[model samples]
Target: MKVIHIAGWSGSGKTTFILKLCSHLVHRGRTATIKHIGSHYCALPLGKDTTLHFEAGADPAVGIDDEKTSAVFHGICLDDALNLLSDSGVRYAVLEGFKGMPFQKVHIGILDGPYLLKNPEVSEVLSVLDQFDDWYTPSGLMKELTDEYPGCHIFSWAGYVTDYQKTKDLCSRIEDEYGDDPLIAGIRARVHRWSDDGRYPVYLLMAMNNPFADAAIFFRAIQKIEVCTLS
Candidate 1:
């Protein structure tokens, strides 16, 4: 998944820009968004069902309507939320107000001054939504990852499959190659079967830290297998 952050001072149009960007992405692909309500308390209605459920110790109170669905998760960390989005098969994730995160950012309005420009991670600065361009199409973003991270391998599958055995086979191959390395082995332990609707796609991304690991081998192994690519 491609993750990016949008940040700016209060009333600097962060929310508006995010809404527009999300609308654009939704028309062309799948997208997820996270808004950080930092340091402020979000109060629920005193007698609402969702609030009552939370008060009764329902950790994440979820409410679904015919038209929409919302979840209230108290005290959840950013990484955990990100993992949830990834597991749900989001292609793009745009975060609002996670400024210091290592993910690339788009600054919505002016920074304080030149001192703020010292940070090297800012990818774009926009004063208004009209300046937005399609520079980061899905294929373009995937290409950027491959260019920036040399050893990264991306495997994707779609369409009807008999079962989860195919994914397991690919994971087994990866484990066979790197299971001896303690760090890689630890990461391998976390790999498990992914089962979601075939209508929605799935992606597996492996970034090898071992300098000797050949990403080409992974490509070659799966070359004959039917797979999806960022288009």
Candidate 2:
């Protein structure tokens, strides 16, 4: 599990960068992402029964629908969010916000001031997410995915990222192992935290050079490799 925190001031394109990062990961056929809204203003209207239930003292009143998007009234906590993703079994959770909280982060400041002195705890500080996916690849995975899937995006992960250094360190090793493969285009880690009460939401994927593989085989390869973390 790797956790890469994407942080910056308002209007600094934090959310936009997150969206693009999600796309790049998905194209590589890796599943990695966990977003934090940092706000509880998005509440359901009280005109409905769900709202009434919430007003009546239910912490989280869920409403499942046929659209495949389940609505959880009130808001979502980090643990709940992680459990949801764990159940889905994604490769990683590219979480948004939760900044300056002891995680490997990418801090984007406008003026590019003296950030090194600040204990912001970011592994990579860049102007944009595009800059981070700066892996050298012969084939253009981004362009191909753009043409083939259009707006569809992919996310991937290797199990358990608790800090930026851990995730970034593993990525460096992954690059050393399969950096030559055309499919191994880019590497980004999302900082995340989950619980053990329910099943884990994500299933880690293996570091592979070949872009094509059956899911079972990929799962096996992922299981064989051990994840290394930096403090």
Predictions in order: lDDT: 0.53, 0.46
Using all chains and alpha carbons, the TM-scores for the candidates as numbered come to 0.51, 0.43
Regions more than 4 Å wrong, model 2: 28-40, 73-77, 110-231
TM-score of 2: 0.43
**Candidate 2's residue-wise lDDT over 1-231, tens digit each?**
234466677677777777766666565444556555555656577688777777887867656667754445455556555545544434345766666445545655552332231222222332233333221111223233334444333334435434544544544554465445444333322222333443222223233334454344434334433333323
Top lDDT hit:
1
TM match of model 1 to true structure: 0.51
Residue 53's lDDT within candidate 1 is 96
Model 2: weakest 10-residue lDDT segment is 133-142
lDDT (Cα, tens digit) per residue for candidate 1, span 116-139: 222222223322223321112223
Clashes of 2: 35
